[model samples]
Target: MDLANSGLSGEAVYKSTCIACHGGDGKGAFPGTPDFTKSKGPLSKNDAELLSNMINGFQSPGSPMAMPPRGGNVSLTDADLKAVLGYMRTTFEK
Candidate 1:
């Protein structure tokens, strides 16, 4: 989805891609995955930091479950990633 220009919003992108691992509530589907509802979770990071981690794939120290590069969807563009993150921030950061 060309989210920057396409009518799709951040919530749509997140549902289409991120819901698998992150869950609809952003609580994460499996162990080691971060819980966005928490104050100290990914919501604490800035866009740049989050984007960089997703683009490069994050493997936190002592963690076995890694989030693959582009969150396993290589077709996603930078704008798509940003959109998904925006959804996460607004929906789960409370």
Candidate 2:
């Protein structure tokens, strides 16, 4: 599928997997929620690190909810994560 069509599916992936806490627009509902629209937080991190964190929950000393391993949704595949990541990047990474 084209990027546009792929993105459409990606939107669904994002909604089902990320919308609760990240908000419908990926703006986040609570504090510390990364504002995807504003490109805030650790945007400087490379894609590899971001992908790693997306696959494996961060286990640092200060993480809340332990980042919820794969954001607590295990059914997602790597492609789904990539699609969701692409969606977030397009939505907020401006």
Superposed Cα deviation of residue 85, candidate 1 (Å): 0.9
Give a tens-digit lDDT track for model 1, residues 1-94: 2346534567877888788988988998877778889998888988889989978899865567888998898888778787787778879997
TM-score of each: 0.85, 0.75
Sequence-dependent TM-score of model 2: 0.75
The lDDT, on a scale of 0 to 1, for candidate 2 is 0.68
For all candidates in order, the CA lDDT equals 0.81, 0.68
Where model 1 places Cα greater than 4 Å from the true spot, the runs are 1-8
| Model 1 per-residue lDDT at 89 | 83
Top model number, TM-score: 1
Residues 1-94, candidate 2: write the lDDT tens digits.
1344333366788788778878886667766666667644544566778778889976434435556777798887767777777777777675
